[model samples]
Target: MAEDIEPLPVPRRIDFDFPDDIDPNWKADDPEFCAMVNGASLTMPYLEPFLIKTVRETARHIDDPRVQEEAKAFNTQEQFHYRAHRRFNELIKAKGYPELAGLEARMEAAYARLSTRSLRTRMAYTAGFEAMTMGVTRWLINNRVQLFGGSDTRVASFILWHFVEEAEHKCVAFDVYQAAYGGSLGGYFARARGVFHGALDVMFNSMRGYKIILRKAGLWGQLRSRLRLARRLGSFAWTVAPYLLRAALPGHTPRREREPQWVHDWIAQYPHAPEGYIPLLDTHSPTMPVPFPSARAATGAAA
Candidate 1:
């Protein structure tokens, strides 16, 4: 008989408050930068639903009470993230980026196909996706200034808050999958396929978004700008490579270095602190000013 697995500890919910003082001229002044932000913002809706679904589905297989608790917390945090990003996406659309709408439609179709897989497969894929997110989070933390340019405190703060939670919950999905599947070969294969597919999805979508933003800003006039951005991103991808490699290796050791004291201190004083706070949005309908699905209801359905 299979031994019963123990549950992991539940994490706390996180809250995000949009900064009220962002420069209105920021987007128009730098179209290329705006495009990058918009592209990232556009990804929230599609990715959030997947996260919500994965947590909900995996909760059933989590026999351990601690793990189940953590899954619940994870669901809440992901919901907060989804809603916040949706708000950011609204700002992007307001800036005349109509391409984002089409992108959302494409992602919806893609996720609909993915939703048909078995629970085990979905769990494996979620683990893989989380691993990749961990890699990206670390890279962003290390290169925040370059990624956002200097002096844009709001955007920098927003991304940092997101990545910190992403880093904290990095292992939840993988641990949950292993517990449910007994570490079988099929489970590993499913995870690997998920990682590959998720990476490709992000890359293609990001490229299209970047191109659109650049063309709109008339920044496409300089061939060097395009090459420069691509090369920079390529370098950043290399930085994330080691994390992905380690994640793929058997019996990999998880990295849990604490955030620098200065960085932590900086984030601690915000209206929406990032470490352990989970923010509740004022509304849930698609017509809301900041449209998003209900985190509580979505996760509750899984439980």
Candidate 2:
């Protein structure tokens, strides 16, 4: 039953170390994938604050106490996440891609403009964006081994932790939308439109950041880089397509997308993890066991 239940979006104050010379390719061997993921990371500082503002404002329209509480918790979790990503994103910029500043500015301006839109429109965008997260979170966790293997521990753990919270609070935004709009047909269409608009908008900006960063890295025009990105994007689409499709349909709630085992383990284990640095995922270990308190203790001892 514990496994069946998701914890609230509890705020974790774990620390991550990102030194001056840290490799932006925390993936170690996968720079192309790094570009894509880091590009997504670059959007977080701007995008998430936009989300927090929109969700918070809409919370006033809903009478459900649980929904309101969830909204607050979700915003708290996002505050921590964006701050962590903002810290790491600084490393990405310092590593070389000054042009990323331009991308960030553009996103900041765009989100500011989006902020002026009606509450329903903003809420719909959030619901749609969050709806896509069910698939995105699954994709990240499903490929954790392949993606984070031998990667920098601090980064790998930080990213996984963020997504774990994402999985935990999976229903908050969608529920907020439902609470605000009730079950109206027009609301359904708005949500459907948001699925496309929100997902495409984020991805478009992310890839633009990717191009700028990769061009600076001298990988943007390389034949191998292009091919790899294409294949990975194709695979990501194939993996997440059904989840996105379902989210756009009527009567679809996030609960229909089951949380993966890792999501459960992460929530179960985090409470016991010693209160300091979040334990790094043991990249060298074949099993990549959940970072339980005892495991964290052992890893700290061995280090």
Candidate 3:
């Protein structure tokens, strides 16, 4: 697949402003879902950079030029994602969750430990995280309306754009991992170990985030919110677990992953924005290309 397909990693720097007026609970009044997303947002700043570091280090071990270029492009995308999410996270923090800072500190410590691992182990971790993210983007795109309906469009657009790019570079890490260790039994076992560790770490971090927010909001022990959170988690697992399992299989490649139609269509459309900007995405119909906003509008207004 590496020789068969060309990677188009166009670096579109989308600036999504989450002004004070925007709802802290932005998912259509769903506090559980809001906390869940906010919790995940905390990881982006540290996690993306960790992933970039892992890929960059692994690229030195890979000989394929295309894979190396894709890794560099993938690093660029992750850079944009973390920077944007860091801004969004400030808004989340301003919403009065003091525990967020503590949670973020713990996240930093965890990644610092990961930074000490071997190159192979680190690259395996990157592959695991990327594969999981690919499945998540698919589920989010397919259920966008249910998840983001009646929410802030600017925030929704921001998240969707990130997910779209996640979809765009879906195969880069897997290909890199394969380039280093494709058919060997050790490779299969390493990939499985990485996926398991990655998945567990994500769940733990997200739960830590959720606890910080939910307890701060006085909703952690509340039965109603607990039920809602459980239901949401169930839905997520139901949609994503199979994909993770598939990735663990021998000879599996992200190229064979089944992306949602709109996601595939999005790459096909290939819409471009001015340098340092991207189009204001229409979340309802992701396939539709809206006109780019004026400079002022992109940075201000309705955010």
Candidate 4:
């Protein structure tokens, strides 16, 4: 049935209005959790461009048309994601984290180092990162209410929108990897290596960013906050452990994985948010949020 569905990688130009008065932890009430998620967001502007370049280059060597098309679509979607996050990062910087720029520069340099590696190595890293994001996407969707409830609407919508797209183009990199390198034992080893490498990159970068944000906010050395952060990390690992293990299997692919119902329902009702904004999720209930088309949609309807 998935084969019967058409590939549509729509480029959305939505923006968020993060008020200057908002706190650093714009999403959840937990300061530690907020810092952790912010840390991850900080990596996108650098990490995503690296992904786009890697996928685009590898797509060139592949003879398959479908894979090529998917690669372009994947790059387009990531383009939207990174740009949106870049703007949000600016908002975070406005909140007085002057040290944030230094952290981002370090991450940029790290990716620059990675760019020198072989094509196969880069593609392996892309596949591995996508695989991990797929797991994180599912986890976030399943626990949407618990994690985002009562959070700032703009920030919540921004994060959910990005992850939803991540889920949408879930299989592109894996397909590219398989097309270029067969599912041989060597391929499996490359994918596994990527998983570890990408995971460490995210964790290390996120932890560093978190410490910077908390230190600037004057919460870094607070024992209570530190303990809460440790517990949250442990719980997150437990939730996504199954996905990490499954991704390591030779035959495992996102094609066999089921898409989350919330993501399904969300996309179905997409373009629903007003112009210049991301679609809002109902933080209080799992029920589908009401769909209201943007001014662009209304203009089309009038036409």
Candidate 5:
């Protein structure tokens, strides 16, 4: 664990009351992108609990109070994130995508098998997955305007809030893994292995979700949709490949990762947000400035 680093993730119970009217295609103009994001969201209800349990189990073997405390905070934030996603997912299912029910069940079963791995493997997986997430959080925030610009308030805010918290605790899983293994050579290989194992597993499941949902939408048969989907997939791979490569290095530590200014602004301004909710990003603004309000119904007007 890095003793020199100050501050850890702050768990907020954001009341993401996604309205029944919230659009399935929240991005409106970009249904392909919407499906991609939806696919990722579908994984959360299943993915998060597994991560929470993994960290909880590993904490039993770790003596570092700071690592254990951060793990607890990470679990708390993950709890909020998955529960919120479950709500949004129900809305998704209701919006003529009941086929997604099968997708979620499959994801649940997949994570169950993953949970049966050794403790070191699970923690390594946790660390590796989080390493990928740190880079992804940066990509999503940096391109917030391009990706989420002019999107539904409920959907956009929910996705944005989820990633922001991801960035907040970027170091927790890695720190917990390091504390347990004491940075051995074998541990280095395990951690590196985890980068691929964890990231690939999640990506495989998410891509499945995308395939199923798009097929249901009848877009899967169209050539144009296929090409655009290919392009989107390529773009994401290109953006995050560097992060994965960096994380695979023997000396890689999340403490040294450089985060963009927006993430910094979000962390500093987040505490002032109203109780029980994270506020919506001002999607309309050019820079998407912060000091956000809550995500509840009364605060329905964009933040």
Candidate 6:
């Protein structure tokens, strides 16, 4: 069935509107908040190279021109995201969050390990990761007020813009995988394993960053503070755990139906969001300008 399916030669590009109500300089006054923001901001740049590498490597296995086009668009959007986040991270550093350097180093090492896998495995993992990101992005957009807590229009707009694009390309990696690898048992197992490991890395790394923030805020010793932290962690776990569990299902399908109505409303309101401003590629080409390193290189690097 996968063999019969063709990848889309051209993927849709979406334009995002920046929210105007939030102040860009709001993070300047809040040290703790700025630290958290910095942690998130630092993640995108580290992620971009991994995404580009994955797309280029997997492109070779794609028989459909459309799929190839989608891969290129995915890389482009990710690059834009990386640049945007880099700027934001710099702002955080300027505000005195230089401790982000160590976190970035740890994240790079983790990704370096991932880069060693076979192309198929890497792509499979990417699809799973992308699916999870789509869910989180959608959830964040739907609950932007709750997440951001303040009326800083700039911060809100920047984050939402990124989420919109994430939602738009959510299906690209999975589609590519199914098209190229036939969604076999081995493929599913590999994907599931990758998702589990990746989730652990994300959770641990995030906790470490959060602890650094707590330490900087001088709240590390208070029991009440610890309880509040636990509650927040519990809440996030409750929110994301179900989705992660469902991902392990043999026929799991991520549907808009399971998400909150606000998410659906946003999706409906912005039906053309994916194609709003970003230009789509006109044609698909088998030959990628950027040649991915051989599987040997990936594995050898890991070794």
lDDT of 3: 0.80
Worst 10 residues of 5 by lDDT: 290-299
Candidate 5 residue runs with Cα over 4 Å from true position: 276-278, 291-303
List runs of model 1 lying over 4 Å from the truth: 1-34, 253-303
The residue-by-residue lDDT of candidate 6 on 149-249, one tens digit each, is 44354555566656656666665776667677746888778767656655555556656766676676677687877776665456556666766677766
lDDT digits (tens) for residues 1-303 of candidate 1: 113332332333344444445542343335455566567667777877797788788888677776677687778778777787887676666666676678788878978887887887777667767777766776765555455544344554566667767766666776667678737777666676766666666667766766776776667678877776666678767966766676666654244423334234333333334445433222222211111234334445876
Report the lDDT tens digits of candidate 3 across residue range 1-303. 355585657666767777888766776568898888878888899999999998888889888888889999999999999999998888888878766888899899989999998777888888888889877887778778778766677877788788888888889888888888766889879988888778668878988998888888899999999999999899999988988898888877888886777665555444443466544555464333332554324435745
Return the top candidate by lDDT. 5
The lDDT values for all models are 0.61, 0.82, 0.80, 0.79, 0.83, 0.59
Q: Write the per-residue lDDT of candidate 5 for residues 105-164, one digit (tens) a residue.
A: 888888888888898999888888898897788778788888888888678777878887
Q: State how far residue 294 of model 2 sits from its true place (Å).
A: 3.0
Collision count for each candidate, in order: 12, 0, 0, 0, 0, 13
Off by over 4 Å in 4: 1-8, 271-277, 282-303
Which pairs clash (backbone N, Cα, C closer than 3 Å) in model 3?
A: none
TM per prediction: 0.76, 0.93, 0.89, 0.89, 0.93, 0.73
The local lDDT score (0 to 100) that residue 72 gets in candidate 3 is 92
**Candidate 4 C-alpha lDDT tens digits along 223-292:** 9888888887887887666777787777777777775876776676654554564566555645324223
Could you tell which candidate, 4 or 5, scores higher by lDDT?
Answer: 5
What is the lDDT, from 0 to 100, of the residue 215 in candidate 4? 89
TM-score of 1: 0.76
